[model samples]
Each structure stands twice: as structure tokens, then as C-alpha cells.
Target: MAASWSELMLSKLVGRCNNFFQPGSSRAMCKPFMVGDQQVGWVWPGVEKHIQRFPDVFMVEDKQVSLCPSLQMYEERTARVQEVMVKLREEGEFIALKGWRDEMYEVFHQRSSPPVFRMERTATALLGVKQYGVHVNGYVEHPQKGPLMWIGRRAKNKSTYPGKLDQVTAGGFTAGLTAQEVLVKECAEEANIPQDIALTAQPAGAISYFYEDERGLFPEIQFVFDLKLPLDFQPVNTDGEVSEFYLWDMDKVKEQIAQPDFKPNCAMVVLDFLIRHGHIHPDQEPRYLQFLENLHKTLF
Candidate 1:
């Protein structure tokens, strides 16, 4: 087994994903995609034609790329792109939108008519665009031990990260609602937390990383939060997405993270929590700085 959480998990998550087409300077290389001089995304070298299938929206010339210059154009072109993604999903594309916020995510520099692609298909519409989500680490005041945390086991039927451990609450950033709004809503829906309690969740910070797979690139930013619960409160799973909940000692939580139990991305959220709360210190972990800095990366 690896000595640290970073080596066993975070490194593999970040290190194994460097195969994306790196959009270089004014000179495009490795499948460059330009949206008005901004390389907002990229595609693997041999995979450009799959993107080329949406000829009207994407222009690939000599492996260099360009997108529709106007929002109106993308609005007109999303249907065909979605059609392909849907077919791809049937062909085994692992797209998931379990707790999707029904708002339209703004796409491209022009801030177009907010593309109508399905939340799952949004990645397909643009291969390298980044998406955002919200994650919160909920804890309680223990008069004797100080603090303990609430954790969830994702439902086995979940399309992604099934049966894995997760933070108290998490949901993706949808087209509508501020992060706070989503946080409150998710707290109630996922954990049965009352609105009054949900409103107390504080904005801790954010963690960003890059991930690529058969579907495409996901350079994501997760806004993290910390909510302290009433001494007697225990989370009840209102949403079926979470199968069960547990209030575990910080030591137990850290132990589980070092295993393959927590959801992969959730592992980093937990690591961030440990560092911020002084549970994981530079004096204890050899590569604490590198691990912290690597989690917040700009992978273009």
C-alpha cells in the first residue's frame, strides 16, 4: 500500500490524465481548439474527427480547431451534437447527471443563448471545457471529543461512484442557482437537513483538477463548504442518491480515505478538509505542499 493518500490516490488521479491535447501558444499544437483566440478546450490527436462529426459547430483544419463565433450559431447546432452523444451513451459512454441542477451552463466566450445540451451531454458538446460542482463537509460539535463528521455511502444504483463513500452533500453547478442556493437545496434533499441548518453552511474554499476519459476532458472546479451541525443532529438520507449516513471520528474518516473507499474526487475534498483543519500537517506528511498545490491546478 502507498504511504500517503496523495501517492495512493491523488497522484494517480492527476498524473494519469496528461494525454489531453495541449492547446499551445499562438501556434496550435496537439489538436488546438480556438474560440476567438482563446483555446477554451482541446481534443486528442486521433479523436478530432469524432468532434468533426459536428461540422457546423467545429472547424478542424490541419488538426487546428475553431468553434462557432456566435452564441446564435451554437444554439442552432447543439441538437445534432446531442444526438451523437446520446448514441454514444447507448454505445457505452459513461455519462451521469444524477443530481443535476436544471440551469443552463454558459458556454464559449460569447455567452451564447445557453446551449440546450443535456447535463450529461455538455461534455460532448465541447471536449475540453471545464465544469463546476459544489461539495460540503458537514460536521457536528462533540462536547467530549470536539468534532466529528457526517459521511454518506452513495447508493449502489448510482450511475457514478456507486456504493462509494462521499461527502455529506454534493451537487453539480447547474445553469440556474448560485452555489449557495444549490448548497441549501442539496443539504435538504441529500441529508434531510432543514433550511435553517442548511443556511449555516460556510464557504470554505475550492479544489480544481483535470480529468480525461473516453467521454472527454473534465477540468472541474469544486466549491467546498463546511457546516457545523447541532450537537444532537444526525443526517437522515432524504434523497435516494445517498443510501446511508455515518458520523465518524476524524481518525476513522482519515483511515477510510487512505483505502479505496471514498469516491475518488471526494478523497481530495476530504484531504482539503484535513489540511485546513490541521488534521494533516506539514510536519507529519512529507509531500504536504506538493499534494496541496497539485490539487489546485490549471491543466490547459
Candidate 2:
């Protein structure tokens, strides 16, 4: 007999949970349980007895509720019951015949399978990797003289890009989201800029770059978008991810871009956008030459 949809879903969840509990375990050992025609993971300790007595109570409940409850009460009750089952399993007290039978029935009648992806911290890396992109905007004003294009130095505690200067508002594209989606999300998270502000800004085309860090573990294909902000726009860092922010004159930025410790790809992306937008002169003296040298090394 074929497994029911609920049974299949439950089995998959249990398999994932088991693997999570015991990382590097053999697949055969962690294979989901199969009981007769039903998958084993789908059968909670006393579920069979409840089914025999209640006769399709599980099925009678709204299918949507059974899958994902919109009601808070149903969710809370289901969580409490699952927690009890987990505790009983851990204590080995459920191995007794009566305890075992009761658990099976209680699980089938009271609990709903939880989502595999909902496990905490399990999704952090996935979330981070998914949010990768390039963002570009010109600070037409000089660092100190005009409205300096504020660049934030990353906090020393950061795992990536530690102590490096980054764009005023930048973000990487994430999975299931668009470039604009990422850019807007990033601005809010990194700079606390209102979503409304981001919506009104114009997109000035993207600068693409491939980068590999010294460790070679941090490889990225970045796409930077140019965003023009109002001269009066004042940015505040709501989060401590940035240690400090400083605005430099366009000339100051050109000098900073030539520094050896500066994050190469980020500086290149910013300069590329500025040069293309006519913010920086192509035939200027020392600053223009330095910019070209940096650009040449970064691109080639």
C-alpha cells in the first residue's frame, strides 16, 4: 500500500531531525521507520489506539489546521503534546507496554508534524548565503567639505569583512528575493533606512565583480547597483555591525580607494559606479591615475 501524504511528510521530518541529532551518521541507521503500510515516523507512540477509538479524528480536523494552524490555541496544544513525547522518549520511561501504547495514541491524536526547516540556527548559514549581491551609490560630495559619502568600518567582531570599510547602504541578493528586494532589505538592516526611502530611489545599473578572499573560502559573484540619494539624506546605524561611519570628499574617497588594506572589490565597485556616472573625471591628475591603477588590478 502507498503511504499517505501526512505519513510521507512526517517521515521526511523525522529523518531530518534524526540526522540533525546525530551528524555524520550513516544513512541506513537514520532511515525513517516503516510500520506495515504506514511510515514509522508518522506513528506516534499511542496513535494507533486513538485512531481505533476516535475513528478518523485526525482526518476530521481541518486539513489546513492539521498542516499549518492559523489558530494559536491549536499550535500551542500541539507543541505541548510533542514536548511531552520528546521528554518521555528521552527518559526511556515510554518503553513500558502501557506507556508505549499511550504515547503512540497521544501522538497520532494530539500532535502535528513540525516543519523540518523551522529548526533554529539550522537556517542561519542558508539565510546568509542566500543574501548575496552588489550595491553601488555615488557620494558626489567630498568626504569632509560636502556631504561626505559616509563609509562604515565593519566591527572587529564580524566573521566576514572584519574591520573593513563598506558602502553606506549595501546588501547581497538572497534566495527567493530580487535584487531590489535584497537592496531594500539590506538598507533597513544595515543602515535603518526606511523602506519608503529605498522605494523612491532610482537604480543606476549594476557593476559585476568576481572576488576570492585570502582564505579562498569567501568567494562571491557580486552585482553592485548605483543608488542616488538626496544630498540631505542622513544615515544612522541602528545596528552595531558597523563600528564607525565617516564621510569623505570625492577626492578623499579616491585617496582611500588606493589604500592596500581597503576591501578591493567594494572599493572597485564604488569607483566604477562613480566613474561611469561622471562623478570622477577620467583625465584628472594623481587621483585619477591612482584610481585607474586600482581598477586595472581589480578587473584584470
Question: Considering every candidate listed, which one attains the maximal TM-score?
Answer: 1
The per-model lDDT (C-alpha) reads: 0.69, 0.44
Give the root-mean-square deviation of each candidate in angstroms: 4.6, 18.2
Candidate 2 local lDDT, 163-209, one digit each (tens): 98878767544324566787787778777667887765566544422
TM-scores of the models, in the order given: 0.81, 0.48
- Clashing residue pairs in candidate 1 (N, C-alpha, C atoms within 3 angstroms): 103-175, 103-176, 104-175
With candidate 1 superimposed using the best TM-score fit, by how many Å does residue 234's alpha carbon deviate from the native? Answer: 1.9
Worst 10 residues of 1 by lDDT: 18-27
Model 2 / residue 290 / CA error / Å: 11
Best by lDDT: 1
Give the lDDT of residue 10 in candidate 2.
25
